[model samples]
Target: MRVLFTSTRGAGHFYPLVPLIDACAARGDDVLVVAPSALEPVLAARKQPYRIGGEPPREAMDAIRARAMSLAPDDGVSVMVAEGFGRLCTAAMLPVVEEVCRDWRPDLVLHETFEFSSVVAAERHGIPHARVAVSAGGFTAQADPLVGPVLDAYGSGIAERLLASPYLTRLPVSMDPSPYDVTHRYHEEPRSAVLPDWWNGAKEPLVHLTLGSEAGALPTAAGLYRGLVEAVGALPVRVLLTTGRHLGPRDLGPQPPHVHVESWVPQEDVLRGASLVVCHGGSGTVYGALAAGVPLVCVPLFADQPANARLVTAAGAGAAVVPANAGGEEPTVLDPDDVRSLGTAVERVLAAPSFRERARALADEMRATPSAAELVGALYG
Candidate 1:
């Protein structure tokens, strides 16, 4: 079958689609991936036909931050979601989505939900379309088991439409590493099992911490860093922290023996060996932990993080503390709003065995998931 996999604009957004793309190709399906202008070469290297365009990364980040700052005292998810809807609908994603659909004329349109580009393309083509959410916004692919309550709770309108679609295939509803049963190249070859770096530091009951790429760049980033450092500084567990390239070791202040902070570390590598993760709940980090059998303590700072954290709590994985724009909101890295408060949350994750148990259970299931190529068989075989 001819398939087009359209992803959102961010590196975090598009990466999840990669495994599925590889799987489909391995299954002998013709696949094309539409991504941001910067990722075209990345896709080509993976052997997928590629095209790229749309807003640059910083532009999108700026938009999100501006909208976030404008939100008044009562503005919350509703405001953010409403604002996001406007930001997402654009001529930018349209050109590529339209062009790919027109040229490929695939049997189906598979897309990452936030990749509003693909969503529009699917609407334009009148082709059978399936949604692959990089996060839990995807109620589309869930089993009949959880569908009823969700539909009943939220109204069946949107969920019903997806469930009713004979052609609408779905990836698994998960916070991290999607449970998309599809075709991929990862399964065809031997995956190099490089565990996340935290393992090298100490032993199990491991604790992983990260503030996300954007969190570390916020004006209040330095204070946030100090808080994170103070929280885990002398803790018994090994801590691997990522500053998101916004700060270097010198800027990060003093470090403890247990904590090793870097601008980047193979996240998946460290998560693979971690027992607990403390993060800002960017879907990438959350899912990375899930894919690796590690539970999370979600410390959401802004944007979709709270929502992402909500999913983590619902999944029996984690909780959120130090809400964005809360009275104690950190204004700059130097703003002191009690960064060490985050440490208590870390302690909770380490002490809570249930969190680890739930993560392990989910990990066990994830490990058994059919690759994207195999998912194709479930639908068409």
Candidate 2:
């Protein structure tokens, strides 16, 4: 079988697609990843086959850079990166994605949910396409009223354009509803990804901390790293902190012996054996933990994170901390104290065992769904 795999512009969105791509390729099926030029090195390094598509706009890049870090976003600073950029990327990629799909004659189109244009391409070709939702927080398009109006408007004709299936199973990792559930829970195993080098098995209980792929990759992510270093100072647990691609050790300040900071780490590699996760409630980070049955100490930054955080808290997988120093009914800075409090929450989940038990149950439920590759076969065949 031949499959055309496409992901959103960022690493977080692209990384989740890797497991399925490799799975299909390993089974003697050809898989092609169509992405951006900037992301080419990322794909090459992973040894994943890919063709570069659109260049994600410098304006879009600058827009992301200009944005401030906060526990929440304002009305204008939506998670979807604004219509102009989406439209531009879609327009740019349509010809190339279509060309690759035509040349590959793919049996199915496996694409991240964010790109409606991919759906359009598949629809135009009358092919089946599966939505691999990269983050659970982005699921609000199906529900949230504030976002309902626009998503409903732009998303109106997707069903006709592409055959929809909850098939491309996202990894069931994170703080809230597992990634499998994000795609409607149709898989049979929790998907896994390649690990980074820093993840070594050690006797000390490992704690994984990250802000996320894009937002965490920010220059200011150092602030959170410093906070984590201070918060976990002298704690018994060993810490693995990924600062994302954009930042470095100097940005993170001096790291304590207990905390090991890096530009990146194989999250799943660490999460699999870790005791707890401290993170911004980005769906990738949150679900990554959940897939491993590790409880979360979540601080949601924006978008669907709050919803996922709610799910995590409700499911007894972990606790939610809104930065205790936040005032005037809402907060701007994510308080370090709240993250420190999260240690207590982690202890509760670790010591009680019930939280971990419940989390593992969720993972089992998540694993009952079919793998993304199998779904592609079913949907396209």
Candidate 3:
């Protein structure tokens, strides 16, 4: 079988598809990935075969951001998904994706949920297609109404076909609990990488702090990072803070000996040692923490983060400290009170045994799901 995978830019979006892609490749299926040039480095690092697709123009993105920023956070997210991902990104990549489908004639096309171009192209070419989940079901539920109109604009009835396609996910049913006949659960293996030299020497009750790759590059990043640092700095436990690619350790200024700052680290490795995770509540980070049976203190920044945070809290595995006026281009700064609240939440999670117990239950639920390789064999074998 020939499998073609498509994704939008960003690690959060692309990473979810890796397990399925790797599973297909391991089974000796011919696999190709279609993504923007911005994702070249990531795909290259994985040694995955790929083709570059169109990227949305910067001016167009700026215009969209400006428009979305004026509305409330939830409203702003709808605009970003509807106009940015559903419309602009699809319009930009559809031509290249169509060309790839025509030339490659893939037997199956799997796309991350937000990447719509492949869905259209695959449908047009009469190839089987499925959407792999990148966030919780609630996020999808919220996005459908917003993006449905955008997809319908491409062609009448296109939205119905695309939305009704097979849905694959790693999220445990307990975490989402949404009923969808097309949904299939797959086990996503934890990724491994070389840990820092200090990793072995880190103390117990370790805490991991991260805002994901994209959030650290936002305009409000400095305030957010600073707030996170201050919130956890005084604690006696070991704190591993990853600044992502855009910022360096020095950017956060001086830190105590217990707080180790780095540009990036393998999150799975960190989670293994972490007693708690304080993060921006991106689906990847939230799921990783839960899969490891580690609790969280979510500080949602934008996009689907707020929804993810809500799910985490609802599951009794974590707590959230959402930023005021979230989801705007120029969001409000994190004040001292907000920092204190974050610190308190972190302390609360660490002190409570129920959080870890709940997290462990969720982890067990995830482990019960079929492995990605098994899913691949069932689908294609």
Candidate 4:
């Protein structure tokens, strides 16, 4: 079978599809990935066959960002999703995606949730397509109403075709108990990486701090990073803070020997020694922590992070410290009180053993889910 996978620009949007992509390739299927130019380096590193597609126009993105600033956090996210991804990105990529489908003649087109162009192109070509979820909560339901009209403008019933496609997800049922008739759950094995020499022989409990790639690049990230450093640094545990790819470790200024700062670290590797994870509550981080049976202290910044944080807290595996006006256009600047809250939450999670127990239970549940390779066999074999 020839499989074509599509995605938008960000790492969060692309990384979730890796397991399925790898599984298909391992099964000897002819696989091709279509993404933006920004992802070329990532694709090259993974050694996947790929083609670059159009990206959202700069002016349109600026206009959308300007508009999103005026709305509430959730409302702002809706606008960005509806106008940015649903409309602009789809419009930009549809032509190129359609051309690829016409030429490549793929048997199946798989896409991450936000990449609508693939679904439309697949529908146009009468090829089978499936959605690989990137968020932990009910992101599809939230996006459909906002995205449906935009997709319909391109082609009648395009949004319906997207909704009707087979849904593949790695989120354990307990983490997101919402029912979906088309849902197929799979387990993605954790990635491993060689840790730095400094990370070796840490006697104290390890705390991993990260805000994901996109969130770390936001204007509000500096304040949050400083706040995290100051707040978590006071704790007795050893802290590993990743500044994402956008920021340098020196940007966070001087740190004590107990607080290790790096530009990036493989999250799965970090989780192996992490007694607790403090993150921005992106779905990938939340799921990774839970899968590793590690508790969390979520500091939600924007987009689906608030929802993901809520899900983790609801599951009893983590606690959340939401900033004021999170998900809005303006960056979330943490105040002194917010810093205190963050510290208190971390302390609470570390001190309470129930959080760890709940996380372990969730991990066991996740382990029982079918592997990505197994799902690939069911889909293509």
Query: Candidate 2 lDDT, tens digit per residue, 112-193?
Result: 7565456667766767777776655335343323333333344565543332355344444443243233244444344356
Residue 196 error, candidate 2, Å: 12
Q: Supply candidate 2's per-residue lDDT for 129.
A: 76
The C-alpha stretches of model 2 lying farther than 4 A from their native spots are 64-85, 137-140, 143-156, 159-167, 171-204, 324-332, 372-381
Sort order, lDDT high to low: 3, 4, 2, 1
Question: Over the stretch 237-298, how does candidate 1's per-residue lDDT look in tens digits?
Answer: 77777787667767877776677777877676676567788887777787677666677877
TM-score for each of the candidates: 0.75, 0.80, 0.96, 0.96
Estimate every model's Cα lDDT from 0 to 1: 0.60, 0.64, 0.87, 0.86
Task: Report the error of model 2 at residue 101, Å.
Answer: 3.4
RMSD of each: 6.6, 4.7, 1.7, 1.5
TM-score of 4: 0.96
For model 2 the local lDDT of residue 279 reads 80
TM-score for predicted model 1 compared with the true structure = 0.75
Q: Largest lDDT belongs to which candidate?
A: 3
User: After superposition, which runs of candidate 4 have C-alpha atoms over 4 Å from their true positions?
Assistant: 197-200, 325-329
**Model 4, CA-based lDDT:** 0.86
- Per-residue error for 308 in candidate 1, Å, reads 2.9
After superposing all C-alphas onto the true structure, candidate 4 shows an RMSD in angstroms of 1.5
Give the range where candidate 2 is weakest over 10 consecutive residues by summed lDDT.
325-334
Q: Over all chains combined, what TM-score does candidate 3 have? A: 0.96
Show pairs that collide, candidate 3: none
